[model samples]
Target: MYILLILAAITAINLGKAFGTEKSITGKSEYALAVDVRVSVPSSAFSCMKKYGYKTVFVRGYDPTGDGKFDSNAVDNIHNANKAGLGTEVFMTPQPRSDKKGSQQLVELYEGLKNGDIKVKTIWVQVTSPVNWFPDTKINIDFLNDILSAAAHYEVKIGLYTNGYDWSQITNNAAADKIMLW
Candidate 1:
């Protein structure tokens, strides 16, 4: 845990360092940025990802249906992101899922990415739907706990994506060091 914090801090510092050591937006030398991608986002879109100078990225690993497996475009995104010299992290949309089911999905995503040799800087689980309001606190909290546990077992840095209120309610004050907001 302490190591993860140290690494995160180092990464954060490195991220900000990319913009040069001048007084800037965050008023801190250490800042970080992340970009989101899905299977539908073609590798061509990343041709200029390096220009944005993001230090981290969130790439989708699963699609919502049918086989419910690894996304076809994930590898291309990972490859392109790597080519752009950005650290990549994988995420899965976890809305409308139970704790048990969400945990399984998390594990499945990890395994699928590993099988494809697509290692990443971290794993992020999505807890919000951009289109709809997810109102079930119990389900959200449960799912978060399960995913957190699975993430620990996998020994990888883990984080979440949600709007404001949903984060506090869904995580129930879970001790995650990183939380991305909508």
Candidate 2:
């Protein structure tokens, strides 16, 4: 009877292993991590991101200072994300200037020798600030159009992120295929 019980226990263990439940026995779980970074990843978060098997990351590309200076956000995150073996994407936000000059600045930033050269998996343009401050559909649309043009000039595809209400009224649903919900 004891021999039979031992054999049953062994079989159950083997079955669990075969079914891939062994990780639970060791308190480990499979993780596929993806994250977004607004400014910086704090450097320390890189290890955490790697621990979770981070494969993709969205890092703010530039702060778009009208003074022709891009923030170190993209540069900082790009290095850390690369060290952590994470794929990097760029999110470019306009500065206080949300008009033609803003788009021109966006293009210049993304096309910068340092900023433009980074390997961005995709470019995501934030629509909130533009809509909130600009308020006029034409202004925002022109902003987007210029952004789209600049992105095209760089040969990068753009992904738009925004909440699905008033901002949507500006971005519109016809662009559903390109919208990414956060």
Candidate 3:
């Protein structure tokens, strides 16, 4: 009876191991460490990374402006990542600079870079789905150009963050610089 019990236990353990439950037992690295530098991750993510030896984490949605001017929430995020010893890459979302609101956002962008440390090695232009489509190709190009020019002037490199087609469209000629090429 004891032998049968031991065998069942061993089989159960093996099955768990096969299904990756062993990671929980061994506390091994399950996910690659990356800091998004955005708003913040949920408690579950924090707990998992804490359990595993995750050397890097990504923080996302950081607002550059403290008053929510451009990205008001980003300043705290940058500080948070720095405190946590994670490298930060600021993802700049595209906003229309043709209007007052957008112009304010641009100012916020400039302020984000200026006030923050030079640790932001890569600037990703967030052109993801829904917000992915530009009013006109020129609109996107012009916005990207402005950001790139700002980054270049600030001694930071710019990278285009987009799906394959959009990225291809931007990189064909005058748009090529230091693309983050996602």
Q: Per-residue lDDT for 1-182 in model 2, tens only?
A: 01101001111232213445555565334444467675566555766666766666767666655543465666777787778777666766665343446567666556552543565446777666433445456666666677677767777777766666746566553344443434
| lDDT values, one for every candidate | 0.61, 0.58, 0.49
Give one digit per residue, the lDDT tens place, for model 1 in 38-121. 744444455455565557656788665653565776777787777777777777776444323666777778888787787654
Candidate order by lDDT, decreasing, is 1, 2, 3
Worst 10 residues of 3 by lDDT: 1-10
- The C-alpha RMSD of each candidate to the native structure, in angstroms, is 8.7, 15.0, 14.5
The collision pairs in model 2 are none
Per-residue accuracy of model 3 over 8-95 as CA lDDT, tens digit each? 1111133212454455564333334444434444445444544554444433332433333445556565565455555446666655
Residue 50 in candidate 3 has what lDDT? 40
TM-score of each: 0.66, 0.65, 0.57
Question: Which window of ten consecutive residues has the lowest lDDT sum in model 1?
Answer: 1-10
For all candidates, what are the clash counts?
0, 0, 22
How many Å off is the CA of 95 in candidate 3? 1.5
Who is ahead in lDDT, 1 or 3?
A: 1
